[model samples]
Target: MAHTPELSPSQPSGSLHRMTAPALQPTETGTGTRQTQLLARMLLTPAVALLFIWMIVPLALTIYFSLLRYNLLDSESAQFVGFENFRYFLTDPAFLASLQNTLVLVGSVLGLTILLGIPLALLLDQPVIGRNIVRLMVIAPFFVMPTVSALIWKNLLMHPVSGLFAWIAKLFGAPPIDWFNDIPLFAIILIVSWQWLPFATLILLTALQSLDEEQKEAAEMDGAGALSTFIYITLPHLARPITVVILIETIFLLTVFAEIFVTTGGGPGLQTTNIAFLIYSQALIQYDVGGASAGGLVAVVIANIVAFFLVRIVGRNLEA
Candidate 1:
């Protein structure tokens, strides 16, 4: 009789409320989720479309042009040539020289920047008078445009007869070296390194400041010398940043054209010609649009391969 007492309309049964509530919850949640997804897609559509227009369209046209025999110098319509353009570009002797020069430029710059950047970063991290001003002065080269930096170095710092380097050499009773003619690739590497060293130093200095002071202090207490402490503690902490620097520098290094274009002009033979300059030579100098298109695609492939490997290396370091 007690159990049979009628419940009030406002006081719903607990079991019925729990069952209905869960059922409504999933439905409401799913509807909200779908709306959020729709909104996200709508918001992303414009950027995705713009990206397609900018990047994909040019890439697609390059691919199409690679299959054609188009020449700026010729008045004839573009003719389909299959893969002959690619074959010709890959076999050109200039291409081989350019590839070699590219590798050497990239490797030497990476080495010099890493070797020099660490020390410079360490020095900047130390307590010094006018540290902010010194850091600003150090990073000033990075702000200089490639063309401008190339001109400055060519005219004011590396000129055999009148440059700053020449003046310094004369001060030391030595002849000024012909930077562009005798060692064009090395000169290119030096200019690029000068521009990028500040970037490396900035990143490394930030990493250094994050280092645990207690560890270094403890190492000092244990009689660990500066070299020993840096090698054992500091270097390992910097592995990730170094990898990041390598990845970023390699991407830009592969496409280094302005410095060579302004300074060396891929001149004194094919000594300083990298792949980017090679493409410019093919398209603008030779007027072979098809061959240049093929070269551009080849460069893209090469860059992708290098990027893939570097990304994998960086990923592994980060995970560790």
Candidate 2:
């Protein structure tokens, strides 16, 4: 072969030139990283800011107030009191009663809604006359304003003498029962369940609709009974939706205030006083800012605890 021409001095050796020619600049790499970080922050900024304003700010204020002997009525006379307010809330009989009532209300409502919702969902999903109208009627309660719903139920359905319950009792040749006095907590539970039942039913019905029809047919062909097919296939398919319903409903139910406020006002000797109403009473009625703040913190802690387990459980089920 003919001898190669001598390379120019300005040009590097072949391998060195290939390796060093126009490598990416450090400045460009740094700029790219900064751009990525900026994009991420830009995307997350709104949500993070909203969460801080909604949850963090109020929480910080509550914690600060809980540590002081502040009263809304006497704000100028607030004194540092460490955990006195917390101690008082934990020790007070009214607070204890309210806590118990809260548990009962939450438990009863959740149980009833789940018990009724699954069947209703199944039934609603079936081909039936007036299915669309029935579904609309079922979900209508959830859209009603909480206070409005409470007032309607209180005045139109439970108004002792003139309400539906009283009318039904009279039709049965029985004395009209005073719902507020004889069954305040149960009454609240019923109202809450009625509002939430549609939510659960809608969720489960959607879940049911998403199930594979072939699987059910195969199960039936394999001699599996209706209950067995439902238990093994349908229920398992509904696990995620059920968990979602439970989590969302739990959060809303824990903060149940308007219903109790309008319907019972935490009456019948504090039997209907859930934590939300208790906090309101402390801050607005009692004018005890510190005590209310302590109560608020407690409610937050309890809610977070429930939420944590719920998320974890739902996450695991989803993974499986």
Candidate 3:
């Protein structure tokens, strides 16, 4: 009783898809690239909007408030005084000290990390027993929270009376040196360098692993000594990574705050105070919003300047 449907065995298997292909065409004008670009823009719109709200809006507010004499403690309304906050912040002697401390901290940590990380990375790269365990132990420091690490270094390690260093000093019949009190800036640098050293090592080690083995073997066959191989081949290979480490580390190092805040409290009388701590003192301790905002803007400008130069350097290295 049913009418038999004719089998179309000669027809292409994708015949249905071919018939429906026109329906799947993008509504947007132009070719595949245009549609893809439109889709990408649509996907990115939310992220772009969120970024503008999060970063740009606050920055604009900071700029606006920087122009006003706004003290959080003062009951009086904010009064507009263009460039006065900037002038005051610049003239304040603390700013100079903070600037110098910032530079020193960044420079010292960078130097320490690079100097130590290179050798550490080389050692880690070599085939050895428990190499994986050694790497894990070495990288463990980086995972520790900055505040926690500062506390550990301060109370457990550096404490003059009841700490590990004090015990070691006593064993050697040398009087224990007070770390934070005697050399506050150095203590901060040490703490920060400890935190960042693993990052440098990890990056350099990864770069080292990607190095061509044949080249090193060839160099050795040609009578290149270990030091010579390092100088001629390894160091040159590491140049780009080193620049990258410097650039990235410098950016975050410019805002070194937590270690100083936790360990030194920017103290023994401003010895460890950097730009970031100075801003915190202004905003929170002194309760001068305008001054803090101005300082913040100054920090922004300095960071931009540093980044500009760093980017130029990195671009040249990349080209090379």
Candidate 4:
């Protein structure tokens, strides 16, 4: 073979350069990493932008309308009113009643769901022949729309004459209680509780299943009874999930509108009117846009306050 020409000292051979140059590799890697980061940001931009617009636009408009003396029918009266709308909304005679009803409804539903859900969850978590079917049946109510559920309960179940509840009452020699007439708030609560019970049951059942078997075994070996084991081990395990359930339910319950609209129409003298229904009546029924916007803001603030307190409590529980 012909002797290879001597490589110049200033210029390294290709193989040598390729083998010895590690610095170039990092620059190329950095470029690729930067490109990946840029692409990731680009991909996320649209969703983030959409979310921001979706949340901010309505909030801004609500605030703007709340500050003006705007009525749907009277365009000439659309002038700045500062906090006057808020004063008017707050001073409305029905506001206090609505606020109280809203709180009672949310609190009662949470209590019932938690109390009933734990037992239901424990029952469902046990080994059964048709466990999947049972779970589906338990969770089926939550899938029903609020309007549809309200209608069913209002007509088929609590009709006070030919409804299922009335028939059951008659069979038991009890008078058929008119649910929406005599006890409108209770009727609303019952309807809402029925809808939410399934959600609570599902959440609690999932949490219950996540309990560590070894801990239970140890407790059993130490002569712990089922009740004691549940009080200690199971309840502690379910704390976080229960908090999550309560928080989520509270937020939605604060704004319950559809059921009241379909069933009571905030009627029987505003007995079943929560904050949401009150706002709806103001805006759509009364056509007082400014007052309704103010009420909506108030409801938002109340919800934020409740959520803040709940989050703080949950944080403490989580830390423990």
Clashing residue pairs in all predictions, respectively, total 0, 0, 0, 0
Window of ten residues with lowest summed lDDT in model 3: 1-10
Off by over 4 Å in 3: 1-35, 309-320
For residues 52-71, could you state the per-residue lDDT of candidate 3 as single tens digits?
A: 89989989999998999998
For candidate 3, the lDDT comes to: 0.90
Candidate 3: pairs in clash: none
**Tens digits of per-residue lDDT for model 4, 227-307:** 999999999999889988998899899999899999999989988888999999999888899999999999989999878
TM-score of each: 0.86, 0.85, 0.87, 0.88
lDDT scores in order: 0.90, 0.87, 0.90, 0.90
The alpha-carbon root-mean-square deviation between model 3 and the true structure, to one decimal in Å, is: 9.9
Candidate 2 per-residue lDDT over residues 1-320, each given as its tens digit: 23334432333234443454468576665565567768988999999999889987888999999999987877799999999999999999988998898888888888888889999998987898999899899999989888888888888998899999899999999998788889989888888888899999999999898889999999999999999998999899998888788888888889999998888789977889989999999899989999999999999998998899788986675544
In angstroms, the error of model 1 at 186 is: 1.6
Task: Give the Å shift of residue 85 in candidate 1.
Answer: 1.7
Cα displacement (Å) at residue 270, model 4? 0.9
Tell me how candidate 2 scores on lDDT.
Answer: 0.87
Screening candidate 4 with a backbone cut-off below 3 angstroms (N, C-alpha, C), the clashing residue pairs are: none
Task: Give the top-scoring candidate (TM-score).
Answer: 4
Q: By summed lDDT, which 10 consecutive residues of candidate 2 come out lowest?
A: 1-10
